[model samples]
Target: MEITLVEGDITAQRVDAIVNAANSSLLGGGGVDGAIHRKGGPAILEECRALRASRYRDGLPIGQAVATTGGNLPARWVIHTVGPVFSSGEDRSVLLRDCYANSLQVADVLAASSVAFPLISAGVYGWPVEDAVRQALTVLNAVDPAHVTEARLVLFGADTYTVAERVAAGFS
Candidate 1:
């Protein structure tokens, strides 16, 4: 697969799907979750509320992902995944990897040819930026790339873009 690195908003990407670094509630929260919900409009929230009322009444489990209509966003669908809250003393990297892996799986089910990803858990979740970037690259690099042709690391700022570019350079 080809991984494109971009320094911009994930919400603005024109792709098959975009991953939201959401909270377990699946309702709109801060950072990427808030942006996707706000820009994607009510359809996304409607599906999420229905999800809560039915399948996800207890909230989405960490490392699990679900898909919903992209609504007004450019993408055909939105894949929501809750990244584990970062703990300095605990190794929650597996949960972080699951966010990407599971999102890709959902995209495949949707027959999405491309997907864009934000740095899951690196924002309000308080993950160290460098480690977050490394983990993302590692997971994406190991994947078979049969389903999705393109996976983009949509960086929201220059600092993280620089960081991502550096870490990704170490990969392909």
Candidate 2:
């Protein structure tokens, strides 16, 4: 797959699938999760509620992904994945990496050719931006998806984008 770093709103990205860095509740909290929910409209939430009532009664597990309609957003599907909170006492990097991997897996299952992702866990969840970039790139670089041809890491700010660009350079 072709991986790129984009400094912009993830919600604005025109792609087949957009990954949401969601809370376990899948109900929409803050940061990228809130943005996607608000912009995508009520259809997204309706699906989430159904998922909760049926399969995800206990809420989405960290690092696992599920799909919902993009609603008003440009993308056809929204892949929701819960990211692990950053912890200094224990290494949770595997969970973070799983978020990207599982999201891509879900996207491929949907036959999505392109995907856009936010830096999962880097905002309110307290993960450092640099490490988040590294984890995201690690999965995006290694995954050989059957349908996904492009993956864009959409950074919300210039500083975050710069960090992603620097980390992505090492992958080259």
How do all models score by TM-score? 0.97, 0.98
Candidate with top lDDT is 2
Query: In candidate 2, which residue ranges exceed 4 Å CA deviation?
Result: none
Question: lDDT (CA) for every model shown?
Answer: 0.92, 0.95
lDDT of 2: 0.95
Residue lDDT tens for model 1, 42-62: 999999999999999999999
Clashes of 1: 0
In the order shown, what is each candidate's alpha-carbon RMSD? 1.0, 0.7
lDDT (Cα, 0-100) at 139 in candidate 2:
89
**lDDT per residue (tens digit) for residues 19-126 in model 2:** 999999999988999999999999999999999999999999999999999999999999999999999999999999999999999999999999999999999999
Q: Evaluated with TM-score, which candidate comes out highest?
A: 2
